[model samples]
Target: MDIQPTSGSAGQTGGFAAGGAPSSGGGLINSDFETFLMMLTAQMKHQDPLNPVDSTQFATQLATFSSVEQQVRTNELLTALGAQMGALSVSQLSGWVGMIARAEMPVHFDGQPVTISTRAADLADRAELVVRDESGTEIQRLPIDPGRQELDWAGVSDSGAPLPAGIYELSVDSYAVDELIASDGVFVHARIVEARNENGRPILVMESGQEVAAGDIVGLRQAQ
Candidate 1:
């Protein structure tokens, strides 16, 4: 499988100081500082000789600028960190290509038997695998060994006729004698054909053309 690395923008924005001037990068910071000096010089020159500007007020203005510059630097650092993490995530997902991932999604039957993986509820003595169509109609029920973790469906009807290829839902019903114990069927395994990014998240594309989030994968193994 040919897996391409996903590219994404870091979405870094320029950090502005208190006066709405950009304070990021060496060049921009120098410009902001020069602007500050010019403003301070003008203020000092225009001050009345009799009632000069308050020294405390000048100190406060300088402190405000300093705070803004620090905030801008912090933002730049965080942006760089975020970009590095995103690159690392893409690199990790690339390794998932050609591996079989177990998840809890609808089965895609394509001429071959579909392999399902699940576990019976605790305290249950028997398990039955229930197959349902797209319209929620129960088509077949097969007795399954409660102790087993994997089951293979031949994609055939009860009369031995081949079923059409499509997506189907499955559920496992656990029973103790005639009493229903639990209903659960959230497990299936499929080979990962490709890896892609969607909405800034890594998505694993299965051989059946289904897309699942990389984080949703419960188990993975080498594809045979």
Candidate 2:
């Protein structure tokens, strides 16, 4: 799979700073507001008696500093949010290893089935679910509900037999009002075989041997 490598991954191209840092290359050394205040105070104290520092110039400088400070604060907040999101994703995905996830797929359900959910296109008259094993053999096929909001699967065989309860991905193809839509289904029930740090971010390795970042998941649950 072609993936854009992030700094936390081993093969990533560049790195990212987790938190705030001084600007690279020679630039402003001190906080802009502090610098402005210091300069303004010096000017006031050393100004010619007849020509004091202009009020308009001081106000402009202060305003500039205020804007710069706000920008710095905003950048810091965004970085923190990103880190928090990554943590949440890892926690959520970790829960799905032994649980059943609802996603769209062509896999069939034989006995008591585990249900997965996926959105079908409005124009889809019929959708197909294709299930493949580790050897990449087509094991099952199921029709989809064109009108219903979601599709369900119990991870069964085409003959309605119970297959081994494990990770099975799905691929969807639907036609709605003569328009075609194709969607990819992921098995959220796989165990996290490994945790990899790429480009300063975390990637979860699924038991199915799929690699995905924490941000890729939408939901998690115990498999029935």
Candidate 3:
């Protein structure tokens, strides 16, 4: 199957870059060690037999090289381990495909009723569900029961005419008598259509054509 690259947040990419794993430290250390050995051989060949080279200095230099080599190998091992972890993350995220995820995002209307899950403030007495179009114009307003966590939105205008199928936004406002207590965006359950890697992190594409980070998902369940 062909895989397509997905765009991700620039902030996330920057954070990933800040890690700065030393992927090439091993090769650089090996090159430097070869040069060190050549220089030591040349110095030995030119030294006088009477004076010769100091054995202590030679021992110290060899010890330093060994320490540097060990550090480089450790870095290489860490880099390999990071790669393996990344692969494992992708494999685990792949299991989310075909599952249902609940997230706070825009909804896509396809000429059918969409199920929206929302939460109201604990002290609120009533809640209102407001639906808006892509242009941010209010299209429908309905009083919702705060006790019921789920509501269905039929694609229709206030005049009982069907609205055009497209992306829309849903928000819930809680009221205490005449005062507005809390207002928050609503969440909806959508099937995971695909999973893609963005900046070494998993991103889920929903059936609503929305792309959200896996971390942003608040709930997950089996697809119906």
Candidate 4:
């Protein structure tokens, strides 16, 4: 328990923003094209035979409208494709529910043992697991084996009492004799409760009440 204080959790929130999907301008453009057609027809009908509409100008107008319409159609297609891609990606992530993912982040201890993954410094002789509360105050420190990659924290404090269920920041501190050598943030194993697409990217909602980006997760496995 000879651990020094460190800058703890900043109470950052992990989340999703269900932004509204953009509207397609297809209908509006279609309506405008219809209006243009009507106007062109009216002009042609009202013009005297001796002063007919210039054919070149009429052709140019039609070509310009066609080009704009084509571009709009392409844009609509691309938008639809992007939506499909996002949905497909989320559908694949949906299977992540009920699985355990490894990521370095604060974990909510709900009276259950939380598995922590960490790496000790290369030259360290001793290591300790440091625990902090939601407010970033160091509350507990416990000895751990140097270079140990994984361990299950029993949610107990330095006083040997079960900690209340809440979010806690966890890390591993390495020391060489009297001087502190290095500190590494620890990754905790948490079960995925939900998966979603936020801003066209996959997001995982963990049982620990934290949301993590799929790319941030280092590992995944069937929940034990």
What does candidate 4's lDDT look like per residue over 1-224, in tens digits? 12222222222111111121122366787777776676556555544555444555555666777777787788889988988998898899898899989888997888989878878898999998898999999998988888767778999876779999999998889999857999888998889999998888888999767999998999999987
* 2 or 3, greater by TM-score: 3
After superposition, the stretches of candidate 3 with alpha carbons farther than 4 Å from their true spots are 1-26, 37-76, 135-138
Please give, for residues 134-192, the per-residue lDDT of candidate 2 as tens digits. 56677777776645444346776667667885555565667655566655563323344
92-190 per-residue lDDT for model 1 (tens digits): 889999999999988999889988886778888998888898788899998888774876889899899988899889988999987898988758899
Question: What does the lDDT read for residue 123 in candidate 1?
Answer: 80
lDDT of each: 0.77, 0.53, 0.76, 0.76
Estimated TM-score for each candidate: 0.69, 0.44, 0.68, 0.66
TM-score of 1: 0.69
1 or 2, which is superior by lDDT? 1
What residue runs in model 4 are displaced by over 4 Å at the alpha carbon? 1-24, 34-67, 121-128, 143-148, 173-183
lDDT of 3 by residue, 1-224 (tens): 22222233322221112123223464576676766665556555554555555555555666666676787788789878877877777788899999999999998999999998888788889988888999999988888886548878887887999889999999988889858988889898899988877767778999878999888999999976
The most accurate candidate by TM-score is 1
RMSD of each: 12.6, 15.0, 13.8, 19.1
Model 2 lDDT, residue 62, Cα: 59
Q: How much is the lDDT of residue 16 in candidate 4? A: 10
Would you list the clashing residue pairs of candidate 3?
A: none
Number of the candidate with higher TM-score, 2 or 4: 4
